[model samples]
Target: MRIIIVDDEMLARGVMREYLAAHADVEIVAECANGFEAVKAITELEPDLVFLDMQMPKLDGFEVAELAGGKTRFIFATAFDQYALKAFEVHALDYLLKPFSQQRLDQALAHARASLAAGSGQRDAEAAAVSAAARDVAATRVRPAERVLIRDGARVHVIPAEKIEYVEAQDDYVQIHSDGKAYLKNQRMAELEEQLDADKFIRIHRSYLVNIECVARIEQAGKDSHQAVLHDGTRLAISRSGYQRIRAVMQ
Candidate 1:
């Protein structure tokens, strides 16, 4: 099986290389020192399996998984035990804690082999389930997202949460308005709403999530309906419930 080992530390990579050498069928395609390099390599190489390190400089393993998740299977290796549950929630094939024995590594590799043999139909089903689970986990995570990662083809857009002025729902996708530019991200409006900070962004309509800081004022569009007037002079329709929610926050 072809593989890529990702870790920020050279020593960790060396150890993994040494352990995998016992398996003659295993070929280490590339070793990445950071998550960014890992993403790029995963996108380009399309290795059968990736041994990803969770705590790395810049992007973490979760972010790397978000960007290149569907490309190949992953076995996350991390020093922290706290991330073990989260790793499986994102559908990592296996979690290997650091300082693991060669036997442990072999076990993870065996698991990956079994998963890969489960047939394309099963893999696709698991991939879809993984995506849903990932979104659910992101939504329920305590810390509000500081940034949003959107994968577009081979490119990843790292948009800071504070920079997002508003989010407009378009069917299955959400158009994120930030820094006078808009990005289309394949995510549900309700899920994105939960993922963002509740205190900052508000649902001004069923189809709109607006940053409260960007609102100039709320204007009555009809007798009972209202519209949010943004500082940029953009007006968005607000539903009755949304109006009440925004009013409570604004007051």
Candidate 2:
């Protein structure tokens, strides 16, 4: 079996590599320091499994998994207790909590090995179970995003979530407008909508997310159309439902 270890800290990667050295059947294909490298390696190497860290530079573990974890099984290794709960929700093979004992690592590897050999029917059943569990905790786990991370070339931009005036969908990505400047992010608008604080950001249209506090005035554009005017004089299209949402909140 081929494996990769992805963690930002070299020491952490070394610890994982040293622990895995005992498994004779597995070959360590690569060790990555960031999610970007992990994504590239996953695409090129296509390892059988990866030991992914939940927190890393650039993209977080969940984002990387969304972009590249489809073809390979992953056991997330993280110190975050919150992610331990989320790991099961995301259908991870298993998670190795930080400072994991040798026994714990062996158990996780055993689980991964067994699952990898299981039939498609078993995988489908497990996926269904995880999906149901995810639904059960989705409501309770709606933590508002405090900062939005955007990568532009070699530059990493961190935008305060509350500073966002609005978000416009641009193909597969989204354009976030804030304080007279716009930033591009490689993310779906629907995903951002769910992560942003609901009380602050609202889906004013299928293609737009508006910061409720930034609204100067909402005007009827025509019989069936409406527009939201921001503090900086930016006007955004609003759907009927969007207008109703604003009305219900601001009334």
Clash counts for all predictions: 0, 0
lDDT of 2 by residue, 1-251 (tens): 89999999999999898889899998999999998888778877889889999989888887677667455678999998777767766578998889898789989999989988896777888889987876676657657878887756545566899889899999889999877889998878987887899998989899999999999998989998999998888899989898899888877
Model 2: pairs clashing at backbone N, Cα or C within 3 Å: none
Residue 110 alpha-carbon offset, candidate 1, angstroms: 0.4
Candidate 2: stretches off by over 4 Å: 119-121, 148-160, 168-191, 231-234, 248-251
Name the candidate that leads on lDDT: 1
Model 1's alpha-carbon lDDT is 0.90
lDDT of each: 0.90, 0.85
After superposition, which runs of candidate 1 have C-alpha atoms over 4 Å from their true positions?
Answer: 124-140
Candidate that scores best on TM-score: 1
TM-score of each: 0.92, 0.77
Clashing residue pairs for model 1: none
